[model samples]
Target: MAWVYLFLGGVFEVGFTTCLRFTDGFRNIPWTIAFGICIVLSMVFLEVATRNSIPLGTGYAIWTGIGALGTVAIGMMFFGEAATFVRIFFVLGLVACIAGLKLTSGH
Candidate 1:
């Protein structure tokens, strides 16, 4: 379904973002390629997701919410980035917003 595509898109968004960090301004060849491929695939999935019944606002909000949370978690786990309480709270808020959008959108 469209929601599945949206979720996969979000996962690929996280993958590309993490690859961006590893690419180091595109100096790393493998990471750069990985990042580019992931980005392209993510966009493809997002486009497909948009073609279904879900409203643009709801789909995009959910996609971005998942992507943001996944990116931060990956950063913290793999890059030694801070996982502060405020950041966690903000991620929770993003989840709440996604839920609210889904409920109001009836999808």
Candidate 2:
């Protein structure tokens, strides 16, 4: 359950970041509001997960890992960001590390 919360939080982290790119420096009211909502939800879920006995360090690492991975994928897919081989290599490495953390976390 805690892990589920953490995963949802991570997904919302991605939501907030992706919305941030569309915010137009907060001038775009709709996107800005969406960003705000996502960020709040992300924090709420993260706090819940952490308070449920997830190790602080492990939870934070996984949360940020999920955010980073999702954001990069969004950038490449929607924003025309480069998807070079080295870039993909590191992304896969990050995925592997996130999985490793989950597998070894003893949760």
Candidate 3:
């Protein structure tokens, strides 16, 4: 399903972003390669999802929402990144926006 692909894309987006942090500004070959692969896979999945009837705007909004939340989760879990209350609330707001878009889009 397109939603499945979109979700995978989001997961990959988070993976690539976390890998980028480990890449140390591209000085680390392994992390760089991992980041590149994850990014490529994310785009590929996103393209697949776009082939379906989901509206471009709705799909993109949802994709970005999931990516944003997942990235923050990865940062907090693996990168020692801050998980302030305000940041968590903002991420939840993004999730709500994604749900609202999907519900209102009639898809």
Top-lDDT candidate index? 2
Point to the candidate with the largest TM-score.
2
Task: Encode model 2's per-residue lDDT on 40-75: one tens digit a residue.
Answer: 999998899989668878889999999999999999
Per-residue lDDT value at 58 in model 2: 86
Candidate 3: C-alpha RMSD to true structure equals 1.4
Which lDDT tens digits does candidate 1 get at residues 11-106? 999989889988988999999999999999888888898887788877888888888989988888888888899988887888898788878987
- Which pairs of residues have clashing backbones in candidate 2? none
- For residues 1-107, what per-residue lDDT tens digits would candidate 3 score against the true structure? 88889889889988898888899999999999999999999989888887776778787788788888998888888778898999889888888998898789776
Q: How many angstroms is residue 15 displaced in model 3 relative to the true structure, after the best TM-score fit?
A: 0.8
Superposed by TM-score, candidate 3 places the C-alpha of residue 75 at a distance from the truth, in angstroms, of: 1.7
TM-score of each: 0.91, 0.96, 0.90
lDDT of 1 at 80: 86
Which is the winner by lDDT between candidate 1 and candidate 3? Answer: 1
